[model samples]
Structure formats: C-alpha cells, structure tokens
Target: MRKILTPLLTILHRNTCFSVRLAAMALIATLPGATLAQGLFSPAITVNGDAITGYELEQRALLLRVLNAPGNTPELARKALIEDKLKLQAAKAAGIELTPEELKAGMDEFAGRANMSTDALLQALAQENISRQTLRDFVKVNLLWRNYVTARFGARARPTDAEVDRAMGRGGASGGIQVLLSEVIIPITPQTAAQVEALADRIAQVKGYDAFSAAATQYSASNSRADGGRLGWMPLTRLPAPLQSVILGLKKGEVTAPLALPNAVALFQMRGIRETGGSDPSYAKIDYASYLIPGGRSPEALATAQRIIDSTDTCDDLYGIAKDQPPQVLERNERAPRDIPRDVALELSKLDTDETSTALTRNNGQTLVLLMLCGRTAQSIAEASRDQIGNALIEQRLQSFSASQIEQLRADAQILER
Candidate 1:
C-alpha cells in the first residue's frame, strides 16, 4: 500500500497542488512497514462470504484521514467495510436498488459535505491511492440501506395525536417562562488553566451586551462566539435545571458567575425573560448520559463505542461498563435542554431514549463523548403540531428500527477477520 502511494502521487502531481502532494507524500511516509508488506488486494476480512480486501481498507482509511474523521482510521475503516457489506446484502435481500439519478445525487451530496464537487473529491482521493469506485460503493450502500429502512418501517412508526400530546405535555399548566440569552464557553487546559480561569472571571464580571459580546468574541471557544454569543428566545424549561433559577434571577444585561463544566467554563448573560402563553410547551428535565472514551475521535474509540452500543440497552447499562474505570469516565445527569453543551444538545435533540450518538468531543477533541438520551420529563405547553410531532416520531422510530435491523444482519452473518 505504501509503495504504491508514491506512484499514485506521481500521477496526481499535475492535478493536485504542491501542498496536497506534499501532505500525501508525508502521509505515505508514516504508513507502517508491516502493513505495507501485505498483499494489498488480498482479503483481510469477509462478511457473509463477501471479501473485504486490504486495498479497500487502505483506501477507506485514507479517505477518512483526508476528511479528518476521528478515531483509529484503520479500525474505523474495517468496521465501515463490514457494515457496508451487511447493508448491501440486506438491501439486496430486500430487493432495494438505486436509480442512476439517486446514485448521482448521493455522490454529489456526499462530496458537498466536504465543500467539494464530486470530480474534485475524486481527484483528492486519487492523490491518496483511493479510486472512484470506493466512494461510489460507500454511497451506494448507504443510500440503499436508507431506502430499505424507510420503505420497511415508515408507516408503523407514525405517532397518534394522543401520543404527541403526551410527548408535548399539551394540556399541562401554562404561563411558563421564556428567555433570550447570550453564552460564552471558554476552554480549559492544563497549560492554560490559570490564564483561562482568570479570563473567565473577568468575563463573568462584564456588564452590558457589548462588553459580554466582545469578551465572547475574544475568548469564547463556542461556535456562537462568532455571533457575540447571542442565542434566540428559548423557553425557561429548555435550560438546565441548575442554570434555570440563576438565569431567571438575573436582570437584563447581567451575566451569571462562571459555571464549571467538563474541561470548560460557561457563562450566560440574561438578555430578557418573560412569561409565555400555553402554546409553547417545554420539558421539565431531560435525562442523559455521557461516557467518555479517550483518544478523541480516533477509529479505535469509535469502534469501542459501537461495541458498547451492541452490549448496552440503556443509560443504566453504562454504569456497569464503567464500573472499574474512573468515576468521571461516565456521567448520567438530568438537566434542561439549554444546560447541555450546544453540540451535545443538538445531537440529543435528534435522538430518542436509549439511542446514542458519538458526534461530540471534549478536551480539545482528546475525548469522544458516547452520548445517550435516557428519557425526557415533559411538562408545560407545546411546540410542534400533532402532524409535525407524528412525523418526528416516525423518523425517530425508523432510526431505532434501522439500528435493530442492522444488528440482526450482523448477528446472522458469518464475519471473519484475518
């Protein structure tokens, strides 16, 4: 694999820039000799009698590395190939096939994620010894599996109006509060701990929107820092329980004292708070868990998260998984939506109870957060209409069904690794 990379770059020299060529050259230099000695096209693994070649693994790993995907690249590549095999097999069994237009669109959409055209993405991959077929196969499997899942389970997953009411707490008490707030989340590290802490203290003391927004622009690591930490009107019930009272007690333009979080310090400024009518309901509490896996977004960490998902059924199951590890490695908390970190909360919002996401990182991407939604305690008014909630419920249910179906396929399949 490593030997061929130089020639691959030679071919790409005319098309890719000098910097990309240098990076690819440097990347090839780091490949272990032992791995390069293997027959590149020989089977490394087999799923349900379908072979996964060493060439496939290498190409996929290179693609992931180019995309800056977290976790052990090789391991993640292996896992992905195994899953792709299963997905394709299942899709075939279900008689699911993609139209050429759908295939082209899938490829286009995938390239767009990297802010590139399909041809450009292919050229980039070619620089790293990855062929166009690798990308095509990956996109095809995903599209087929998605179509299969939607077709198989779409109808049965829709929620009734009563279920939506229950989910929204529609008939419960009204007059809940809503707030407009700004936020600042400063990162803390061992080297810069003292400096960041001092800065956070000073930022907490800042008064008026301009002062706070300036501080956020200068020091906040949050994505909202670009917009001066400004957040839209959110219901009080959406805030973490620990922060709700503190925020409510603040007058306009006053900021809260610095609050400690996992490897970060958070400060919120109260822009406005007001009582809301019955139409806008909110949650009382959201139960969730975060299990930390070291090595940031490396492939090994991602593979471990997948194994954990296979073994665990709920948040409680994480306790047992982390029993002998450090206490901080696993955390289960019930808080308001606004209290969770924006990234984690965003992932949580899309998930149903017991469902997990590995999209969040902490400690400067030095750790991966295996986040799971334990449950939600609904109360107050409402947001989505019955039809919208029904659609959401259907999507959520489909995710669960898709996961289960894949698990079943994996269990039944004969998977062998060399």
Candidate 2:
C-alpha cells in the first residue's frame, strides 16, 4: 500500500517551535541509504493497519522536545510517539479534517502568544534550524487529534440560551458589569508634573463629562486618548481601588478631576453604561458571517480591509468573497453576547430591525475578524429570555460529559513507554 501523506501543520509549543513532518520526510529519504548498512528499520507499533516506525518516533521526538521531557526521558518521548500515532489514527477513524484556514488560525494563535507575526514566527523557527514543513506537520496532527475528540464528544460543546439567561441573572454576562471606558492619560514626567497637575485641576471644572472627555482626547497620552479615553466597562472588582471609587461616585454624564500618580496625572469621564437585559428588546439573536484574518493588523492591512468594506455591503456579497478566501461561516442560532466575542455581541446590541451594524471586531493578536450582524428578533418580553433552570442544568451536563470523554480517551488508549 502507498504511504498516506497529508499537508502538515507546525507544532507551536510554548517554549519552542518545531517542524515534525519535513524531518519525517527527510528521515524517509535517508532511511533508504541507512538500510544499505543496516537491516530494516523496525516499526515501533502497528496503528490500525499502518506501522509507526522508530524513524517516525525520532522525528516526532524532535518536535516534542520543547515540552521539557527530562534528559533521561526517552521513555516519555516513546509514549508521546504512541499517543501521537494513536491520535492520528483516531482522527482518521473519526473522519476529522482541518482546513487550511483553521491551520492558519492555529498557527496565528501560537505566534500571537509569543508576540510574533505569523511570518516572523516561521522565520524564528527556521533560524533555530526547524523547517516550516515540520512545524506544519506538528500542528496538523495535534489539530486532528483535538477534532477527533470533539466530534466524538462535543454535543455538549456550547452553552444554550437558557443558560446564558441565568448568567445574566447572576450579572455574569458582559453588560451586567464590565463598562468599556475611554481615558486620557497625561504623563507626568518630573519636569511636566506641575503643568499636568494644572491641566488636571482645570479638567475637573469642565461641566459635562463629554467636554472633559473631548479635552482629554486632545491631550491625554494614553491609547484611549484618541477615543476620548473611553475604557470599556468592567466590574468594580476588576478596577484598581482608587480608579474604582472615582468612577462609581460619578453619574452618566459626570467627569473627574485629574488625579496624581507616580507616572501620570489620570483624568476620567463616564461615557455611557454597559447594560444587560432590561426594558429594551426582550430577546434577539444575530446570525453573523465572518472572515478571519490572523496576525496583528497593520495600517496597510486595515486600508485593504476598509476597501473590502466599501465595496461589499451585504452578507451575500461577503459570501461571494468567502468562496475565494476559503472563509469560515457559522450560522449560530440566536446567540447571547456572552455566547460570542464581546465586540460582536456589543454590535448586535445596537442594531435596529432590518438594519446592519457598522464594521465591528473580535481580536486576539492572531485572529482578525470582520463580522456582519445579519438579522435579529425583538420579541415580546413575556417570553423575554428562556428559562434558566434547564439551561443551567444543560451546561452542567455538558461539562460533565466533556470530562467523561477525556477520561475515556485516557483509558482506551494503550499508551506505552520506551
């Protein structure tokens, strides 16, 4: 039978990036040469009908090294190889596949945690003498194993509407506590302290928070300065003690005077509030179609995105683009804000019937999303939100179910040591 080969994904470990597959390909080639001197390279174990050989084991070991196996730990390496082999076998058995986009997403996510761009990420590994092909293989195998588990056991993967309602009841959802606030930070260099303090004192005199916020935007040194120092809302518990007290003391349109700090004079204004279920639309769900671009976005990249936005206004047009981009489209049944990325949720909260949202976002250094809130339901409050009692029970069931699946995989596999 022919050897089964597939596209590889690089295994991006926390400490090191290793290529698992290109090394495997290299070994496959040199094994033919080595066999001239020795006998046949023996298979370590038989996976289904296929054999996993010592050469494959060594290659995977090279990829797994960043996991910090001890110096005398050939045994652990051997166990890892078997686990990997079985995982790939299980994935194929379960018919799980990773699309190129998912592979990219996984790669981008790994790179982001390391504070590197995807391209920079590949190069860093190459500098350490690891090939991109090897890294890709590592990522692909792990992803396969992950999908296999989920396909077999993820019916309990997500939360239901009723459960989200209960969370809202407990003030756990985004709007219930977190308030996105903008800030203008005036840096107080030793020389600038007096000037900044004077500015801070004047800021307190401004009548409305908006006037103060506008001035801060013009002069504050913080990142939120451009947006009028608007910090997204947060629970009081999350804030620094002093900052919390000031904001809590103010009302919807209030402004605070500049306060002193070691490094800066910070001024604050209350932009608005983050509210949960109330007298507004009783229940709503937004069906969104997204195009995920991974890696930190650049001005040029955003410019290109702005162009894409200018030309395509409808979801159908976005779909036309997705056909070529190999995009990911998910049609979630009426989702709560807590059920989705906070930014997307906030956008959904602002929509009117038959209306579309302005361009909005969800960002991790790796994942760049362009979301369109397609449709929503503003139903009667009588059935406002679903019953939380059953929903909470369902969530509990799902968690228990996932734990059981992980345990089963642990028990079912014949994981061996060297």
lDDT assessment of candidate 1: 0.73
Instruction: Give, for candidate 1, the lowest lDDT window spanning 10 residues.
Output: 13-22
Candidate 2 has a TM-score of 0.34
lDDT of 1 by residue, 374-395 (tens): 8765654244455766677788
76 Cα displacement, candidate 1 (Å): 2.2
Per-residue lDDT of candidate 2, residues 1-418 (tens digit): 0011111222233222232322344555565566723332476565444566665555555544443333444555554455556667767777788899999988777667556677876775565445687567666776776666556655665566534533433332233444445555565555666787888888777877678678877876544555666655444433443465687777766766666543456666676665564333234344555555543244554565556667776555766655655435323234643455543453343332223432332332234445555554333322444444445555566546545654565577654322
TM of each candidate vs. truth? 0.43, 0.34
Segments in model 1 whose C-alpha atoms lie over 4 Å from true places: 1-38, 170-385
Worst 10-residue lDDT window, candidate 2:
1-10
